[model samples]
Target: MVRLEKDLLGEREVPATVYYGIHTMRALENFPLTEYKVSPVLIKAIALIKKTAAEVNFELGYLTKEKGQAIAQAADEILNGQWQDQFVVDALQGGAGTSTNMNVNEVLANRAIELLGGQKGNYSLVHPLNDVNMHQSTNDVYPTALRIAAIWLLKPLSEGCAALQEALQAKEAAFAGVIKVGRTEMQDAVPIMLGQEFSAYAGAIARDRWRLHKVEERLRQAALGGTAIGTGINANKKYIFMVNDRVRQYAGIGLARAENMIDVIQNADVFVEVSGLLKALAVNLGKISHDLRLLSSGPRAGLRELRLPERQAGSSIMPGKVNPIIPEAVNQTAFHIMASDMAITMAAQSGQLELNAFMPLIAHHLLGSLKILTNAVHILDEFCVQGLTADEEHCRNLLENSQVSVTALVPHIGYDLASKVARRASEENITIRAAALALAVLPAEKLDAILDPRAMTRPGIAGTPK
Candidate 1:
């Protein structure tokens, strides 16, 4: 069965059982863009905002005790994951999330009415705009909700990064004694411990974790009470003070009201800053994945220093082929994250005077990026990083064959003589040790001690034979 609901734009037939009413119905007709609905995290954030507003308005006597209690209870139910499907608006809607705000308001109002022994859409008993929304505006509530949602999403992303870091650190410890030839510009450069390479990956992820925490700190400052234009117009002063406190209590996060509400409302640079950090993390993950792909390139033809876990078949026709699918998947996720950052940047900069009309887009991309990145990091840790194995013999063979091992002899034989040794090794297609021996640069025992790949990976210059 359907019920008729009306507004200034006229009436529309909505399904009678839906908690959302006419406004959401109009939005559903309006923005038929992506099939993607608004994030449940965001919906919960908005519910918390509404719940907090109800509690605050009730405390200040702006709402009748019964109505406020009912509204708060309805919002709490939504927060606890009830009737999420009633929020039917597209994630990409216009009107600066007014559609989203209205969706939340309508759902809460109807649910509240139900609790009070009235039918849904009976706005006469408990209005969506009057009782449920109370003193809130989309301008303030929407952005505040976005901030809360971002913080909620970032916590897991941060934990995912830390877990990935720990996995890399474990690899670092496992590979500590494995010496390998390090490369620069895709050419062998010097000897380095395989552990050092993994350690650097761990350090990069550690920094990403730290940066995400910093971004969370900025996101925790919200603009909830600055209704419409940051002046808290049409809202009670006491309501403004107590609303954020109540929201903080409900969210269990360290959310505070923005000091300069106008700045928070007008500028979306905080999200831009967050996108930048996420992009940085994407770049780091991409680089690490690329290195993994290169190091684990081939079992027979390429730099087979590391063996990635064989997760799947590489080709349809090949009988026994396994590709580095995990790292490649991470690389693609990084690409999407970087592109989302660009979208977020454009949306953030496109904000006009007092309020950004592009908040829906911002919220969509920001939360989307965080969610994808968190999943990507977890996949990379579990599928790739944790299962990686170093080819100890391959590493030793590469170190033995590389002319760059002459780099360790530089201080002992002087730069000029080391250059001769490197040139002669390349010319004769011989190992640096063989070239040094043919040139009679040092006795065999001395050459053996000096050209040790393990010793070369450690600190301090080569000491003269004692």
Candidate 2:
């Protein structure tokens, strides 16, 4: 039996097939450089797919021992990381991962042939399609590999979010008693503890984490047995169950059979759901980055309540300047994820009756979102959060200058008098205490008691209830 390369050559010499031929070797040369190049995530996914496929073929019971062994050997080489060099297809392409699947088949088949003491592409002995890809279709395999990939990504993403939550929780605990001005529409309206603000960011991330996990659960329903459509038309019934079970075991994921294989085959809602989760994460990160930029704005003019780490030099000419480069990077990543989301939305919407057929874009965008969010979260946590400091002096100055102090006066001086004092404080650039003193709305000692920003920040003890 001769390999595809040997058959194409017609002699012992290897043939120069198209850069990335329909087979695995072509996939390698064609996709020699790509962001979608094989990752451990893809390796594990392909391993699961191949293992499941082999189990299915075995259950079909049509092949002899040698043929089954050939398929198994090729899959083992992949699982053992021997063919890492061959998986080069760009995941961003529109082939719906057909080239990627074929890459796996060709490389594995060629490796299997070598193991069997034959030249590569020896289809008569062990064909890539006949022996290796016995009962699988790209439609089923692509989505299944996606689920496997998502499962791989979910662990670190969740853990990274948890780490961020912990960092925020620590910030909350660290700043719990430290009061600062809380602004509405960029104007101070009330007082809240610095810790409360950090805790709120953490809470937002926590909820997003729960939402993403729920999204991942929807990803568990795969279209593996659906083949070209929901019918599983050419596949053996025993093959379906065996492959499903084996893939589940091999991947260590709880991928159950789809109840409506037609719906699974036709729709790309699962990708949509995952994309939505990623968008949520990106939105949250954007908000967090925006807040960081705002909080760290000025050591002289703006609200300098919080200080992010000085990631890089702020200006080319300005010495003693540090910029929030990490937060800026976070913002950019969020924008990229948002753009990816638009692609996912379009792909999801463009699906025809039977199949979306735009899954390549879905995978590309969703996977890009996952990768970006993961790395951004890491940078935010490691460089930004780890070195963050609350500017106690800035917090004090903000609270001291805040007209929100007059919130306590609403109980003692009444709404009308308090509004007058607040207006005076704002228009005249005077402290609310001084404004109250000038207005004779309250005595100096009484005004101090009623308008203390610290008391207002504490809650439930700012003033007597009127």
| Predicted candidate 1 versus true structure: per-residue lDDT over 1-466, tens digit per residue | 9989999999899899889999998899899999899999999999999988988888898888989899889988988898988988999988999999999999999999999999988899789898887788999999999999999999999999999999999999999989998999999898999999999999999999999998888888878779898988888888888998889888989998889998898899999999999999999999999999999987899999999988888999988989999889999999999999999999999999999999999999999999999999999999999999999999988887878778889888899999999999999999888899999999998888887777777787754543
**Tens digit of lDDT per residue, candidate 2, span 62-122?**
6666667767767776777666756666665545677777777766666666778876645
Give the clash count for model 2: 7
lDDT of 1 at 238: 84
Model 2 stretches with alpha carbons more than 4 Å out:
1-40, 458-461
Candidate 2, residue 384: lDDT: 94
Question: How far does residue 20 in candidate 1 sit from its true spot (Å)?
Answer: 1.3
Give the TM-score (vs. native) of candidate 1. Answer: 0.96
CA lDDT, every prediction?
0.91, 0.76
TM-scores for every candidate against the unseen true structure = 0.96, 0.90
Overall local distance difference test of candidate 2:
0.76
